[model samples]
Target: MTAGTVQALVVCSTASGAVTSAGGPVSCGTDAKGNPLYLSTVQAYVVDPASAGYFDAIATPFDYTQAFGFWSVAFTSVVGLYFACLGIGTVVNFLRRA
Candidate 1:
């Protein structure tokens, strides 16, 4: 399906004989066998304007703060590990010399 029409659909019937779509409601009818039936139809849309981006090209304001926190935690962990390795190497070198 194109950008307009729904690609797939799912139908469900409750114990109370009520049928509902994913969220929308369609027409109800009865078949020749006298069973309640619900029909879901999809129509093609020639134009959809909501897909267009109306916000700015840059990231959201909150995302900038989140990114900063993420990098700060990452760099702090990296620096801690670097110092740990350096201390371990110094201890090993001193032991070898002794």
Candidate 2:
């Protein structure tokens, strides 16, 4: 494995039996073997207004290998669409007399 960055997310359960997420996506550094060193013992806390202490806890367990996937046509399609829209907008703006 090689050293790199990985993505993580946090899911929390409040004291009032409410479930929420604190992190949609956060970047973390990996070790030389491309292992998420910090995810080994990762956790997060949240605030619950309905609770006494108004706090919650989240378990942030993730696998570095599970973070990566094979590059697919979806990426290419999105990039293509972006550039296509930009080019169309530029041409439309340039041709406008106003």
Candidate 3:
């Protein structure tokens, strides 16, 4: 979540039927017949430099224009609401004086 850091969702699988990571082989537990059980899982990790290029193609660019438009709309809404409340308050004050 920091600058220059790349996050990746990795699905661990083994062509040879043995899952592994940098530490060592990953295992869930033994089966009823005592065979080693491997579990494929979805894991999130910070991608290394070597694999960063693969993720670049899927990365989305920020849209500044759209963001600016949304900000303008929000500002306008707040200003309009303030003026509306001021006008209502002035009307109530005038009626009370009458």
TM-score of 3: 0.42
Worst lDDT window (10 residues) for model 1?
10-19
Angstrom error at residue 86, model 1: 0.2
Q: List pairs with backbone clashes in candidate 3.
A: none
* Clashing residue pairs in candidate 2 (N, C-alpha, C atoms within 3 angstroms): 48-54
CA-lDDT, candidates in order? 0.59, 0.47, 0.68
What would the per-residue lDDT of candidate 2 be over residues 1-98, giving only the tens digit for each residue? 22233443343222122222374323245557665423222233433344423223334565555554324456777899999999999999989955
Candidate 1 residue lDDT tens string, 1-98? 23344343334222222334566554465567766656553333432344333333333466778899999999999999999999999999999999
Instruction: Point out the higher-scoring one by lDDT: 1 or 3.
Output: 3
Every model: Cα RMSD to truth: 13.5, 20.4, 12.3
Whichever of 2 and 3 has more TM-score, that candidate is 3
Stretches of candidate 1 off by over 4 Å are 1-62
> Clashing residue pairs in candidate 1, if any?
none
